[model samples]
Target: MNSDYRKPLPGASMQGEPVDFFDARQAVEDISPGAYAKLPYTSRVLAEQLVRRCEPKLLRDALTQLIERRRDLDFPWYPARVVCHDILGQTALVDLAGLRDAIAERGGDPARVNPVVPTQLIVDHSLAVEHNGDDANAFEKNREVEERRNDDRFHFINWTKLAFKNVDVIPPGNGIMHQINLEKMSPVVQCRRLDSGAKVAFPDTCVGTDSHTPMVDALGVISIGVGGLEAESVMLGRASMMRLPDIVGVELSGRLAPGVTGTDMVLAITEFLRRERVVGAYLEFFGEGADALGIGDRATISNMTPEYGASAAMFYIDDQTIEYLKLTGRDDEQVALVETYARHTGLWADDLDTAEYERVLRFDLSSVTRTLAGPSNPHAHLPTSELARRGIAVDYPRAQQDEQAGR
Candidate 1:
């Protein structure tokens, strides 16, 4: 950690007082004048982690990449936590159990082995709908069926909760992992106390097992999806190595039409971004249209990150983010911390006015109509107005008459 960059955050009352945070903006500006003010929101959060956790000796070069928009060198990213569904989570745990046994055989203390980072495994994917929704007892029936079908797997998952440290499991029927993460798990900003008794705050970031994990990016947390092996590495406290991604700015303008839904806007965006070739880019969405949206609408867009082929879909921290945190029932003190830290550290939306991006794309919300995706591909933007011309919306009676006439 770079103690030189560690500074106290004002107006943040964690335990009746303020807490410390890594001064990432200062660090960036020291290298290049006015560079921090131009960094995208994603880069700012990444820089904070590097400032707080990256070795002091390597800090300057890492911040240089973010400031200068270079990606030639690899830097370290230590995700704050890992989230997973039952299947991949089980696989990673099984691998760890095997490792423990191997260690025991080599005269090592297997009990000492545990996940270094916090992990949450939700048992969401294994349920089979044995009864349809029309049945009032459908949920109960399906849950029963799932319990019976996966008894052994459930037993192992239960045992892991106790046998392993830093492992928490959410049993089946609660909700989908991505939805639960957005509504419940992620705290836009997280706090941890150092051994010296000083508390420090940083953005809540995570890696999840499913692709839809980016759904929580709606909350301004830099959550991303990774495969099981990548998740395991993070779980074991190993840094995910990476060069800076292509951080693209998506400036939204205009208001959505009255009848248009968030789904409509996202479908359109998916197609536009795909066509624009944003694959593997980290996207930061800002502007009047983005500000007009609630978190639910933002989540709708972020949930389809893979459809647009972007690594992440991010929104800036602003009043909308604060409101959503309150709506989701986050702690008042934590909420205050989020606002205070962001404003003080140049993470607020207002602070981003001068921010620059390597590439910028403009999207108009009003331009989006009642839209839909392809019959096959998610990015195949299919507006409802085009359905008939595209031969998708057939006249039922005409089709039947044609069939009768063997046309």
Candidate 2:
């Protein structure tokens, strides 16, 4: 939004004072009174980011493109942040360090080079399983192995902590990066002070180095995974330019039957979505089935988004989200902010019944049974009873003979 169109946040401030922000609600309302809430969660987050940062010349076109679902026109999106596990994070930092040396060699101020946005790396990728699960000291033993095995890499990671700005490192054995993000790193709503002395409230949108990054999207964040090179570009404040994706509304109805866990449901849904050729689509799940699921249940589905080849799997913020925040030990005030911001910005699940999608597929959770996924493909749904037919329960000697005969 232009300066002339900016409005103050009702309960937000930079320093105990009111703050002005680009009123995304007003912008979409200018398009149509009922337009804002009808946008999919993914689309709403994308629109807000564009409204906040897109150039004046390109702003209207971009917003119109998204509002109308014009897949023909491409647009630019600036993620609020970037997340990474040690494997990619370490490499990116090393590249930056190398770049710094190259700059110094060119008589430039090497120290001036740093990430322009918030970047966090968790040392989650490597750890030796030196202790078995039955051991009482398993976690400690694992940590010991991790520290010893990754001594050199950890040294470099520690150096980067002091060597660079706008970077935070979470030590190994903390948890998986996706789990850490879900449990702590990601704030469902982000509040930041902009250069104009305004504190803006927006979704916690991000891109990670692992595809399962969408796990946080269950909390209403617009998170997705990108490769290291792409992640590096985003870390340096580059816009992720792209054409609009096919946003598929997956209307989940009915409840899961007895013995049908959330995992079974996800496997079933993944198989269903994959079969529908939902590759690269943004999937938004709604209806009584989706609403009945807790945040953890939603996370199980979102975490496996890549398994079905979809770009993101998102659930709109709702009471489950609020309850989850409190259960996870988030401060009371922060939890309240999430609700207020989501409600006001048209991102709340209750506000999205009218959301529109050109293409849609429906799945019945009740039809989902106790399932076994696969020996290979994640979306390959193999019923436990058919394990033998799928060669998963084959006779050992027969299989060995067949293998020896090169069959």
Candidate 3:
């Protein structure tokens, strides 16, 4: 055991002490360090497990599986649950409906092709924020427009609501999916009965079709946003396999200035991290700065993991994670169990040591400025000072030219 190994956390004992925790790289060896350099946060977690769990000789073979053929690997991904907002959920169901048609044409039973996993779809994304700032009828008017514009989509979704099994649909006019997940959907700790009827507690983990799925990571659940293609495979019970990634430890220091919203900080970090090119790497944020951020703020940052092109932006189980579980309406007993399990199992932030990483990055929060990202891509940041340079200000001459052209 390394002398640096921290003691096991309080309830994390189900897996044993800190010393017994798996070494990320001990299971796999001798790959070009450069290749690991660019793997994203989500890829990093997948790699770590593949290295630590698979047979030693097959480690390299397994690592190369995704890289060599781009074929889906056979691994176990027990997602806590599946989440979707209406647009993508509807589209995914449409694909399934179309697949059903294809399968039926091929002389297979379409009814047998239902999702094997529990799926939740919310109808929220289509609501345009056309009306703003607490208008009494804004929601109603928005709903009306939403219904008109999305008639075809809704017709299909309504059909799915009745036709699909192992699926639940949250009708329109609810809050955003991420917010709802934070407020209602995600269960910080999940319970399952074993074959012998003994209940077991494990860390909650899931994959959402939307990129913002990582928002739940702030609650210490290992949730990630995946593309529709990859999600389809997982939906059908396929393991997303790959080599271990370079775990990048990002140490955030300092505090945001007053009046700076979490949004501002995230936009700034997105710009900085993108410049550093931590693409396709698993990022673990730690230090005094992380402690300073509220769970909501952390969720905001984690939600944008895809925007930065990384896989999982993870914050380890810590006081923040515990507090979030409480704030989000998780049962007190379950929240306590999460704290207990994480501490005992060495999954807590403080217990991570031999947990090796290929690289580390430092960020100073005090330096972040009030900002927004837009016009084209989220990474194309336009600091307020550079707005004129980016042609954001209206040009009266050009407007006049366009007005005359219209006439």
Candidate number with greatest lDDT = 1
Ranking by lDDT: 1, 2, 3
CA deviation > 4 Å runs, candidate 1: 388-407
- Residue 55, model 1: Cα distance from true site in angstroms: 1.2
Model 1 weakest 10-residue run by lDDT: 373-382
Question: TM-score for all predictions?
Answer: 0.94, 0.90, 0.72
Candidate with better TM-score, 1 vs 3: 1
How do the residues 73-126 of candidate 2 rate in per-residue lDDT, one tens digit apiece?
Answer: 779988888898999988999999999999999999998888877899998899
Candidate 3 is scored at a TM of: 0.72
Model 3: per-residue Cα lDDT at residue 62: 66
lDDT per model vs. reference: 0.90, 0.85, 0.68
> For residues 203-297, what per-residue lDDT tens digits would candidate 1 score against the true structure?
89999999989999888889999999999999999999999999999999999999999888888888899889998888999999999999999
- Show where candidate 3 strays beyond 4 Å: 1-80, 98-111, 129-135, 371-407
Give the runs in model 2 whose Cα sits over 4 Å from its true position: 1-4, 12-20, 384-407
Q: For each candidate, how many residue pairs have backbone atoms clashing (under 3 Å)?
A: 0, 0, 19
In candidate 2, the residue pairs with backbone N, CA or C atoms under 3 Å apart (3 or more residues apart, or in different chains) clash, namely none
| Candidate 2 global CA lDDT score | 0.85
